[model samples]
Target: MIRMFIRDEAGFVVSAELVLIATILILGLIVGLSSIQHAIVSELNDIGVATGNSNQSYWYTGFSSEKDFANGGFSAYTRGSAGNDTQDDCDNDQCDISCDVPVNEGPKSL
Candidate 1:
């Protein structure tokens, strides 16, 4: 006579610890990249400000004559003057020795 034996099969196991570790690593990488992007943007903003001042200074020095001032830099520093004329076709609004132009089209010439 022969006896039959039954065997139990083992199922696959999923480790929660490994999943948590992977998630933390991904979050850290995302945070690091975000910080890097923020720093780059900040530096670019600073650069833009510096270059803007330099351009404005050039306009002031080169086009500060009475005639150019009357015609608003003769189309050179047209938008970099102390007035509020929107026909100058310039990017930077009118600026003077005291304050900058308001975003809402107000004048504060110094």
Candidate 2:
């Protein structure tokens, strides 16, 4: 029976065809997946570059700061504040500094 089956050769042809088809399919899938991944990475990189190069700075409009409020709790050093401003000092960044600069004392929340 084994010798007869081996002599047939039809099954071998079918198996070879299946192997070829499977290889083609796998190769196609790999190429497609690679392309998709590359495209996504490129898009993400573009987004990152755009985000990084974006101008997230706020224009210097003006500010409303009281030199004295809540006792004399002020120092001569404060980030994004007057040289003599305390942590409690008024700053446009009461919310977020990204959309805040120069201090627009009008509307607080945007």
lDDT of 2 by residue, 10-75 (tens): 643557889999999999999999999999977966675555554454433343445568775444
Q: State the lDDT of candidate 1 residue by residue for 43-99, as single tens digits.
A: 976675555544322223233234465555443333343422233332333333356
Query: Best by lDDT, which number?
Result: 2
**In model 1, what lDDT does residue 80 have?**
46
> Candidate 2 — worst ten consecutive residues by lDDT sum?
88-97
CA-lDDT, candidates in order: 0.58, 0.61
Model 2 TM-score? 0.42
Query: Tell me, what's the RMSD of every candidate?
Result: 17.2, 20.9
Q: Each model's TM-score, in the order given?
A: 0.39, 0.42
